[model samples]
Target: MKKGSLLFVFILLLSSIAASIGFAQEIGKDKLFVAALGDSITFGYNLQEDKTKPSSQAFPYLINEGNAEVANISFPGWTSSQLLGALSNQETLLALQQADVITLNIGSNDYLQAIGLQELIENQTPIEFTPELQQKIAAASAQLSQNLQNILQTIRQNNQTAPVVFYNMYNPFGASEDPFLLSLHQAGEQITLTVNQQVLNPIAAASGSLLVDTYSAFSGNQAAFIIPGDIHPNAAGHQVLGALADQALASLVPAAPTVEIVFSTTEKTEGPVKVTVTADQDVLEMKWLPGEQTADKFSAAGNVINGNTFDVPENGTYTVYVKTQEQLEAVKTFKIENIVSKEEEEPPAEEEPPVEEPPAEEPPAQEEPPKEEEPAEEQPVTEQPQEETPVNETEKEERTSVKEESTTPVVTVKKNELPDTATAAYNYTAAGAVMIMIGAGTMLFRRRRARVN
Candidate 1:
């Protein structure tokens, strides 16, 4: 073949492979993934008063600016060291590996620890500024800086280009104005600033990360953002953070994966349909749900045992959706009407026809040679012929010949047409042996190919 012809053929092959293997990939994209890591602020601490799940208004929950998945591992009261420990967890590590955007908020508790303060802001407490406390502050500051550096390194090991946003800590004690408490608050604010500017900011800049200044967002309005006398943000504060994160993530949204479901009737009944969604061989962790449905329909809300296909046995209208790989990507629903169950179907029983009575075998008609007319014998009526003398051997033989001429011929069958059982058994045995040989050959060929691979 000429060089141009070979090149054209190769190009066609490449196109065909891409079309088949990446069926869910639209022109050029996959789902966007966002990973949120750190403390109470990112956890939406006081946003949900009644539930453990984060409020819908939480920043992590609101990070979805497009086709996106969010993994929120934030916990309340977590210090920089605590977060550094959490990075070793398999779930957190896996989420980082797949992240397109990551938000980090830590070291706030470390700052609080530096001052040796409990969870309280007292107005009348006296200040005893000692050298021992100053040493504690310095040590806490050093630990916070090291942990922050390590956290960034751990995340960078898994991902290179994801935009990691570092949230600078906000001071929540502006409402306390007693002389001693006011001085303590000032020191706390300065500690937070030192960590943000000296520890977090430079690394973020060097790593091409975004630094969101939460201090400015809550600086003048700390009482409104923070819960009364508590460090956690309120619902309104969560909203502010969510909006900030959303604005930061506006440019990183990628195209979502789409799935096409092809269905086939499992039986002639057509009520039970087999719904198929293609997936990569390595894919695991799938969640299924009925995305759209009639009120009367039974919902399909669980993982399917089979990899890509599910047998929908309900007789109602619905669309089932599937999410794969930590619920990062999902395709539109696979629609189905009545899917029938094959086991429930039975073919109608056939009625045997009434047997006919065979006609009785008729006796063969007896045919004797028509009686020959006897020659007139007037003398026999008058008198019997004189008795013959005792017959000799030759005369007996003549009498047997006369009797043989008067006997009738009998009919008989020529041959029977019944099948030969031996011949039929031999033919079946030969066919079975041939099939066994073919099957054995096929299995051996498959085993050899497997070994070679």
Candidate 2:
């Protein structure tokens, strides 16, 4: 084979081995652990298919990717303070410690309950911006600030390296569209904006984590995202939220992590040598490389796992590689001795040289009368076959044409209930992340956590 073809095959072989190892790892592993802390959004409130199972379209299940196990400690009507209180719960803290990713959304309920915005929304009365209410909102904002920092601190204490995702609040109050309610809507929106900027942003900055702008993701798109007659996001909105979480997980996944390769037997005396390579540390994937590839390019793409076994076909050097979700790569090389087969081991028997002999005198040929073949001159006739090649070919073509005509159209397109944001980059831009305020028609705590998407 050409060198390029050999390289391609080498890559493919490694990928296959990597896939097998990864498959085995996946089968052997427990599902990826993910934890979320927040309010009703995290709890998956009204969008229930039943009491026991949460909505499949809810952000966590939507982001499940079939391999993640989520510990959603959030509950309905949970304010930031309530989330802080729940952090003391053993089950919740354990989940955080074991989580590969965590998401948090809080403070919205705190703001809403404090400002009594839900009461105002229900009553259809103009909010007087009462002095006492302003003090409460300001106090709520302070609590939100402190609670957010504390939440992040607690998460770090559990899983210091797992990425944490928190989103800004969305505005759910029906705004200026209603002339009589302009002031109320405007005031609520202003408060939502305040929480996103003043409360969430600084905390995210301090924690060195992501602050997804749910406000941006849901703003103006409420008709598609919010529940009818309620402030919480609808099932569709959950997808958007999930997509944001997915993006954070995708981006944070470290490049293929470095691995240490191990071999069961580094040297071989015959064909079919089995060498097992391994990484000492935790890894998401692993690969086996043939002599043709450089270790540098082994991690360009494809899933791999902790250990892989290879059947060496020839006497040559082979490299084993390991990769982790953290983007590290480890390599080790081992050589197999020139292979010796049993058949080739024995010596050949000796043979004597043959004696030379003089050429024999030309034997007198018996004279035979020359028979002249005059077929062309005599116009010899030839028999035609029963079927002509052209005729048979034409019949075959006709049959093929008939078969083609009888074939039915195949279905190739499919509709997905979920959004395809797998390739969508997170829109961190303020212009792109339009805030959609959502609450109990009053406040929104949009904290969410981060992992294994």
Candidate 3:
């Protein structure tokens, strides 16, 4: 071959390899799976199911569109401790482990419940303070903090590479000067702030975890966004929250090379399994990083390059991390050993018993004699002479006439009584007449004296 032809062939080979790398990196683009774990707020209470879609909100939706998946496992009345318990459960842990993004909106219920207990204490009979109740509140708050910490720890243990976002509680109680309301809110706020500062912030800083601030977001617009007569946000409120989640996710996972990777298994395992991966940008290669037990046991088929699978070897715990062509990494964990197979247990055998015979019927009893009928008694009657009465139409007419006459007199008296304006007018007229008389008398006396002089 000529030198020019050989150089062209080499260039073509380089272009093809570059194209393949770019295709691999674009996997799992615009797709995301998220597990939203929290109370009613995280569940988007009163929010339409479709409205909770990632494409609806700017924040969470943005993150969702970025090849992320979300699974909302939020319970309405769940507290932080309840969430911790739920997350620690084998089933919840397995389900949550599959998520690329995990968002938590707990602690509000804890604070709310605590405040309720305080109210109950305040309203107690005999006005006696109990050391036990005080201790309970303090203990609950402490446990809440600890539970939040434990939840973060569990997530980290299961999926260290997945970005775990903790959203701080918003002010459920709006700005009110009422002492009781204020005090309750203060208690809740204290717990919330403490958790964010002492527990969540520390965990995030230490382990590269993400923190989303929902407290400040809802504080300013509490009246407009918050649901009427309830602490949960309305539709507009969810929108605001979703926006915050989106921003948090974006910051947590910036635009980078991504690849979609899927695993094929003969039977579904208790899985945090990879279903698919689509590339978003250019990259050199792609590979599945399997868990400890599943590693090096399975191989890829078709266009799936460098794919692998593993059986969840143990019941206790496990973690798996994935590496992309651009070196961007994501991790998920599963508790495979805890899943029970229904086919393994055997059914109990049926048993039969002998039947008992029925007893014979008894004979009827003898009839009783009929009693004699009593004769009806007649009622006694008495007659008395009626007295005659005389009609007095004339007396009746006189009484009616008297009443009419009295009413006429009363009407005349009321008419004769002077009104306030009339009384004042009469007094003014009398005073004017007296002044005229005095002036005339003085003038006449003065004229007589002048004539005499």
Candidate 4:
């Protein structure tokens, strides 16, 4: 595919997604939404700057200024049945659901269509309340009553608290000079009174809707309220209706009661919890119930639970309801599961004594000076006599044995005395052996001399 075609397709896909996900402009949540439903009287038929659009001078638009949003659902020539049918449309249903207030000016077309008033007026025929016309009006009146009931019911199904302005029809031909028109005006006035008193008034009262007295307000002022030669209201007429609608709505809707619930604890724990409730107005009564409940569903009775503090038992969710003296009610709900007991309720056992450590030994004492004491006695010893005769032999044997064992003998020599010999003969014998050796050598020498001679 070409790039241009592909781009166009992508754009179309994005547009479709945006539409599907709701790019439609939204009414501000803070602004009051007023849904206006009726015939051309509420639509501002000839008063529109652009004929295709709803009029800026319409009663719905004049009802409020910057703080409100208006959805003018009225169209040209919409009868009670048509309006009732329109309530099923998506746009109308949405408007009803969002409306904080609604203004209704229907049933005029129902009367006109049934009686063929336009045909009579176009042919310049004189007006007469004939049996056929009376039959048609009566039938229309019955239909209007049923249709009005259904319309209010539908509005409440979508929005429970929005105030409705039920407008009764007016006689627009009262100021006409033409005989036929005057006759038509007189008959219309009677029919208008009958319809308003019998059909609209009772229904509006039963539905708790505000009934705007348009018939009385526009009684003889049709020239000022209605456009010249036209049954639709002029800008001035719409303005007057707007002021009346505003007044009726203010009275119809009571001030919203302010109420609050304060729980002792929002958490789960063991034991009962305390709840306190407060309101800006005088509280007639209050009640406690299991789980959450709306004001309509609050069926608790037999006990007036209103007070400073109420104890809620453990392990469940509960809703508390407060009804003011004005009959308006408010509800608050909370969840809790109390299971654990408080510590102070059960005291702990006494603790054991701590273990003791052994004592340490004392360090050694420093040494002190010695004290004098008596000496121990020694024992006596006995002496033996010495043998003198074998002294030399013993000494000679000792010397020989010592010499046999070892040649050198270790002797202790005192400082003042020489080392004594073991025997005197030992020294004498060593001298004799040395002298005999000398004699033998001299004799041997002499014998050799003689042999030579």
lDDT tens digits by residue: candidate 2, 1-453 = 456434443543343333333323333245656687888888778887563545555687655454668888887888888898899988888998776667888877888888787677778877777789789988999888767766766676666545677777888765556754676667767888887887787666555566688887877786788897777888778888988877765654344444444444545355777666555567656666666455677747432433366676777776666655544556666677756665655577778899889998899966554454343433433433222113265654554444333254433345465433322122222213233222222322323222222
Top-lDDT structure, candidate number: 4
Which portions of model 2 miss their true places by more than 4 Å?
1-30, 49-54, 64-66, 128-130, 174-176, 255-453
Supply the global lDDT for candidate 2.
0.65
Decreasing lDDT order of the candidates:
4, 2, 1, 3
Give the Å error, residue 40, model 3: 1.6
Tens digits of per-residue lDDT, candidate 3, 137-235, equal 566667765676567666655654455666776776666686666654565465557656765565445444456788788776878888776677876
Please, what are the lDDT tens digits per residue for candidate 4 over residues 1-453? 456435544543343333222211222245667899998888889996576778888888877453557898888988988888888999889988777777888999898888788999999887788898899999999899878867776776676556677788888887567788888888788889999899898766656677899999999998889899889899999899998887775554445567677778766667687878777888887877777777766763423475556887766777777777766678777776654566675577889998787888889965453433333343432323222222376766778657434454434335574445544456555545555656667778999999999
Clashes of 4: 2
For model 1, state the Cα shift of residue 207 in Å: 2.3
Local accuracy of candidate 1 as per-residue lDDT tens digits, 67-114: 556788778888988998999999899999877677888878786766
- Candidates 1 and 2 compared: the better one by TM-score is 2
Every candidate's CA RMSD: 37.2, 48.7, 43.1, 26.6
Error of 2 at 280 (Å): 25
Pick out the ten consecutive residues of candidate 4 with the lowest summed lDDT. Answer: 19-28
Runs with alpha carbons beyond 4 Å of true place in candidate 1:
1-31, 50-53, 65-68, 119-129, 175-177, 250-453
For lDDT, candidate 2 versus 3, the one ahead is 2
Clashing pairs in 4: 269-338, 269-339
